[model samples]
Target: MEFSFSNSQKMIQKEVRRFAQEELAPQYSRWDREKQYPRELLRKMGSLGFIGTSVSQENGGLGESYITEGIICEEIARGDCSLPMATHVAGHLCAGLLEHGSQEVRDAFLAPLLAGEMIPAFCLTEPGSGTDAVAMQTSAEKKGAAYILNGEKSGITAIMDADVSLVFAKTDPAAGAKGVSCFVVPRNLPGVTMQGYEDLGCNAVVRGSLFLENVEIPASYLIGEEGTGFKMAMRGFDISRILLCLEAISPALVSLEETMAHVKKRVAFGRPLATFEGVSFPIVEHLSLLEAVRLLCYKALWLRDQGRSSSKEAGMVKWMAPRFATNAIRDCMLLHGHYGYTKEYPLEQRLRDVLAIEIADGTSQVSKLVVQREVMGREFLPYNYR
Candidate 1:
C-alpha cells in the first residue's frame, strides 16, 4: 500500500505544476471574467505532450500512466479549474478510445486526438439520464452496413468545439446494460445538429447538446463490439472520476492557501484575522479534509496504474473529494466576509467552479448508491426500486 509518488511521477508532477502556475494561473482571472477558453494554450499543451499523456507512444502519445494523467489534472486544476475541462478530460476521453477502439478506428481518431489536432467528447449523459446511464434514450440501430442514430444528448462538455464525439447509445433496448454501444460520431456528419447551453460554472469552456436525427455512419464507427458500450463507458468514468476529484480538490487547496495568506495580513479590531479562532479553526478543518481527500484521489489513481479494480475506491473518493473540496471553498468564501461575495477576488468564482463537481461525473446520491451496491451487493437495490 504505497502512497507516495515515484521519482518519475514526482518529475511529471513538477513539470505539470510549473506549466500550470506559469502558463495558466496568470490568465485565469481574465479568462474567467471574459468567459473565454484559450485555444492557443490548448495547442501549447498538445505541443508539450500534456494533452495525450496516456496514449501509447506508438500512437503518437507520450504513453504516460493514468497516475501521471491524474497529476496533470490536479496541477492544472490547482492553478485554474477550467484548464482540465479544456484539455484534461478531453485527454481522458481520447485515452478511453485508444484503450477500447479498434485498430482502424484508432488510426483515424487516436492519432489526431493525441496530436491535439482534434478534440473529443464522451456523450453518455442525456436529458433523461445521468447517474443511471442505462436510461439513456439515444438509439443506434444497425442498418445494413451502417448505423442510424437518433436521440439527443445534453450537458455534454466540450461538444461545441470538439471535432468528434465518443457517443454512447442503446443498440439493444431489451438487453439493458448489455444493450449499450459506443460509436465514433464526427460532428460534420449528415443529420447531426448541435444546440449550445450554459452552466453556472466553468464558463470558460463550451457546453452544448448534440441532436442525432437519423445520423448515419458506417458500422466501423462502433468503438467496441455491440452490447459492450456500457462497460466501456463505465470504465471511462472510473478514470474520469479521479480526474474530476483532483480538479475539485485543487481549487479548494488554492482557496485555502489564499485565505490563509489573506488572514495573515488583513487586520480586524487591531489584529490580524488569523488571530481569531473563528477564522483559524475553519482553516485547520479545511486543511485536514483537503489532505485526506488528496490521499484518496492519489490512491485511486495509483490503483488504476497498477491495473487493480478501483470501483469501490473510486466511488468512495467521488463522494468524498468533491464534497470536502466544496465545503472547504465555501468556508473560505465565508472567511472573506463581504469580499467573498464580490467578484473582485477569485473566491466567488472558485466557489461557483467547485460547486459543479457536486453534479459532474456522479452526483452525491448516485455515488452513495455505487458504494452501497459494492458493499451490500446488487440485492441491496431491488430490480424495481426506482
Candidate 2:
C-alpha cells in the first residue's frame, strides 16, 4: 500500500534525468532524422551501468531493482523517446536469456553485451507468427553436437546492428509450444543474414528480418531446458511490457510539460492559451491519465520485485499506456498549431516515436486478451476449447 520511492530510487531518477537531458536530448532528433543508431552513446550508458539496470552485478551490471529499471527507461524516453529505450528493453530481454543460459554462453555473449561492447536482438516473431508464438515456423534440427537452424524471423528490433541474437525455434515441431527452444546465435555464424526495414517510427533502432539458412550452432548454446522457450519468453514479456509502458508514457508527459510552459506564455485571441478551457482541459485530462498509467507501471514493477504475479497489471498498462500516449501527444501537437507539426519541434517526432510502441511488445488487442485470460480464468480464453 505504501507508494513512495526510496532515496536510492529517487537518486537514480534524478541522475538519469540529468544525463538524458544533457546527452540524449541534443542528438536524438538528428539520429532519428538520419536513421542512425547511437552506438557510441549506448556504449557510454553501458560503461556507466545504465544499460544493465536490472542485470545482476555478477554479470557486470548494476543489479538495481526492477522499479529502478522502469525509472531509467522513463527518464531516457523523456529525452530521445525512441531508440535508446528500445535498445535498453532489447538488452534486458537478452539479459533474461543470459540468466538462464549456460556459463559458457554467458561468458561468450552476456559479458560483451553487458559491457556494451556488443548489441543483442530478441527474435520471437516470425513472418507467419506474432501473437500466437506457438505457431512459429523457425526450426532447429539436432545434428550430432550441433543444431542446424533454418528459418526466418520478422520484426526483430535492432537486428541490423546486433552482434548476437536470442532466437526461439522449434526443436520438436509436432510438440506445439513444447517443441520450442531458445538459443543464443552469433551473427557471424554461417548462413546468417539480415535485411532492415524502413519503419514508420523508431527508425534509429531499425527493425529487420533475420534469415537463418542451415545455420549451425553448438547444442551448448541452447538456453535452459528444451521445449521451455515459450514459457521463458512469456515471463520475460511480463517484465518487458512494464518497462515498455513506461517508455511510451514518459515522452507524452515530457511533451505535456513543455506544452504547459508554452500555453502559459503564448497569447491567443488576447489571452494566454492556458486561460482557455478548451486547451487547458484536454492537457489536464492527459496529465491525469499519464500519472495514472505511470503509477500502474510502477506497481507492476513493484510486484515483480516482490516476486508476485503481475500479468494482469502488466497487460493493463501495456495496452492502455501507449494508446494514451499517442493520443496525448497528438493533442499537444495540435495545441502548438503549425509549429508542432513541423520538424522544427520535437513534438512531431514524439508523435512518431510513441506510435510504434503500440505495436512493439504487444498489440492493444493482444494485451486485452492477456487481461481477459487472467480475470475470466484460462478456460474462458478465446483459444480454449469446449
Q: Highest lDDT: which candidate? A: 2
Worst ten in a row by lDDT for model 1: 377-386
TM per candidate: 0.95, 0.98
Superposed on all Cα atoms, the candidates' RMSDs to the truth, in angstroms, are 1.8, 1.3
Tens-digit per-residue lDDT, 148-206, candidate 1: 99999988887778789888899999888999999999999998888777777788877
**Candidate 1 to truth, TM:** 0.95
Per-residue accuracy of model 2 over 77-144 as CA lDDT, tens digit each: 98888865555655688887777888899888887787778889999999999988789899999999
N/CA/C clash count, model 1: 0
What C-alpha lDDT values do all the predictions have? 0.83, 0.88
Q: What stretches of model 1 exceed 4 Å from their correct place? A: 382-386
